[model samples]
Target: MSTPTSTDLVVGARPDHLISPHGVLDLRGSAGRDVWLSYPFDAAVVVCGLPGSGKSTLLRAWAASATVVDPRVTRTSFEARMPAWLPYASYRPWARLRHMHWLRGELRRGGPLLIHDCGSRSWMRGWLARTARRAGRPLHMVVLDVGAPEALSGQQARRRLASRRVFALHRRGLARFLRQVERGGQAQVPGISSVVVFDRGQRDRITAVRFGSRPS
Candidate 1:
């Protein structure tokens, strides 16, 4: 991992209004309690991580009421209708397509959106960037940075481990993205306005993600 730079340093206790001028904020090693993040009213927030990283958990904790587009939610809905014996792999493609359709509809709504993504797809980030730019909204990313062992533990806890090959692929992708972020090239993702990085230990410290509201 890249050593923390000056820009990555933690801010004051009240950091609800902090936005890095360089468009990236690293909070992986920050020590704070009840940390809050606030963004614009129409910001497109993308929560990214490995397959087993606690992306879904973080989203539920932070943006429970927002318009969230989560693939897992879509898949669960499909699973609810399918026979118990049927495997999710059997209809993964259809579920993915449905999720994309739902994402498109949510994007067009032009309000605050919290998206759960596996950080492996650059194309999806590009699409989100374009959509945000079109609507004059900011595109922000929240990355859950965890080691393979930690991620695997998370998967085991959730009882949904990804295949070895798939986990390796996602690891590579997330590594590449983090490298770019370290090199200050995250802006190359087109319209990414800001990025907040958090390690596993720092996850629970984030109390909430507030949008278009002043901290109380």
Candidate 2:
């Protein structure tokens, strides 16, 4: 594995700022406070982070209030029908294809959506950006930032550690993406209009993720 730089491992706390189609908002250093994020009714909110970076945890919370498209949920449903002893690795390709299909359907429907993804694939992000743009809906991203150690600990806690090679690839991809966002170059991400960053501690402070014109 490649050694990670400080910036690649941790994102410093920064105040919110928007440069038209690009915005950087950091949810950190807030104590005893709740954070609420609001967007238009048809916005597509993509939740991204490294493996075991609490992406699943946050998505679970939003599931009740939002239309969430989670790959894990698709995987779980697949597991429900298959034999219990069968490993997920065996049917991973099918599950991924199914997840993508679900995502495409959701994008086509064009309502408020909170999508869970690794944010490591430029092609996937590009496709999403293009689809949202064509539909005349804004695409937003919520990134969960955490160090490798903390992410690994989370994996251990969840008993679902990614393979070292896969994890390294995700780290490299996420690092490159974060570098661009932190540099105020989110416009470089094509149709991604905003990026909201949160460290593990700050992520827990989120009270609700409200969408549309209503107060959050």
**Model 2 global lDDT (CA atoms, 0 to 1):** 0.76
lDDT of 2 by residue, 1-216 (tens): 221112112234332221111366555453444555666677889999999999988888887766899888899999999999999899999998999889888877877899999998888899889877877788988888886888999999999989999999999998888777667555557677777777777778665676665334
| Candidate 2 Cα outliers beyond 4 Å, as residue runs | 1-22, 28-32, 80-90, 213-216
Query: How do the residues 69-109 of candidate 1 rate in per-residue lDDT, one tens digit apiece?
Result: 88888999999999999999999999988998887778777
lDDT of 2 at 79: 97
Q: Name the TM-score of candidate 2.
A: 0.81
**Candidate 2 clash pair list:** none
RMSD of 1: 5.0
Question: Which pairs clash inside model 1?
Answer: none
How many clashing residue pairs, candidate 1? 0
